[model samples]
Target: MQKDIYVVGLMVDERSTKAPDVQQVITRYGSNILCRNGIPSPSRERGIITLTMEAAPNEYEKMEQELKNLHGVTVDCIHFSQQESFQVCQK
Candidate 1:
């Protein structure tokens, strides 16, 4: 059975935020990062990044923690969509 989950992408500074550090955190919790986009900001303080991935059932907490642990980085928005399951209805 396939379960639905909310995938939360994050954007943060690269220099300020340690890449290996963040990767380690995510790896600790077992998260598959689909894609990561790095965008340069006006100030080097922190850059914007976008992550695309899928989460398991009720695994948002894990993803949240992984990203939140990083410095100067926070979850922008989490878009969740419902996934339908297959079942037979009886009369």
Candidate 2:
């Protein structure tokens, strides 16, 4: 099995009401997380978080499912695999 790199984005609509639960779920999957960055909305009522990680397909799917189950949270993910390569050329 090959592991892939994934970037996950989470948006919490009611930060004060939902942040704690979201944090707990994130903690439960701490080992799979490589780095995390979070920012609060200007009004302080919402939050956005970005996570970078390396995980097996199943591991990521499970985390996505759990996060999606939260009432006021939205999750999105982008994955990069070893089989894909990118290059930039200037003309």
Candidate 3:
């Protein structure tokens, strides 16, 4: 119900092989994603992606699950509610 800020950390394995499918899922939820940053491992076989999101709870949860469903992906998240975010800034 409270939609504020959500951070999704995505770990991708075999970048060249798995990225397209991962990308498809991301594109489906593109509107809710505020920004995305992806960094590849030095070997270029793995990647870490961070996404800043603002969306309804269910929407983002679904996105998280979909990413998790991928074979070579790992997902993690951090959430901040609207009031909590303001409180943090004021501190």
Candidate 4:
């Protein structure tokens, strides 16, 4: 069996209004997250967050869905195979 790497990209508009909720969900899935990076826009009105994760398919989807449910937040995921030479399995 081959292991998979999951990369999630999150764009949060209206940071002041949505960051708390985003933080809550990130905390809920803390164990599955391998790395996290967050950057705020120059005007401090929005934020971009990227996460590297290792999780079962179901759990990953659940986390993505949770983030999507929040207003002013957009989420995207990329899946890569660890056994291959940087092969991307999904986007």
Model 2: residues with Cα > 4 Å off, grouped in runs: 85-91
Clashes per candidate, residues 3 or more apart or on different chains = 1, 0, 0, 0
Q: For candidate 2, lDDT tens digit of each residue in 2-87? A: 87888888999989889999999899888989999999776787899999888887888888888899999988877786777522
Q: Tens digit of lDDT per residue, candidate 4, span 1-91?
A: 3336788889999997899999999999999899999997767888999999887767877888899899999888787655554443343
Off by over 4 Å in 1: 1-9, 27-31, 40-43, 83-91
Q: How far is each candidate from the true structure, as Cα RMSD in Å?
A: 8.2, 5.9, 4.9, 2.7
* Root mean square deviation (Cα) for candidate 3: 4.9
lDDT of 1 by residue, 6-61 (tens): 44445566545566676666666555556567676656756565655555644655
Model 4 ranges off by over 4 Å = 1-3, 82-91
Worst 10 residues of 3 by lDDT: 82-91
Higher-lDDT candidate of 2 and 3: 2
Task: Note the residue pairs that clash in candidate 3.
Answer: none
What's model 4's lDDT at 3?
38
The local distance difference test score of each candidate is: 0.55, 0.84, 0.83, 0.84
Q: What TM-score does each of the candidates earn?
A: 0.56, 0.86, 0.84, 0.82
Please say which candidate is ahead in TM-score: 2 or 4. 2
Which regions of candidate 3 fall more than 4 Å away from where they truly are?
Answer: 83-91
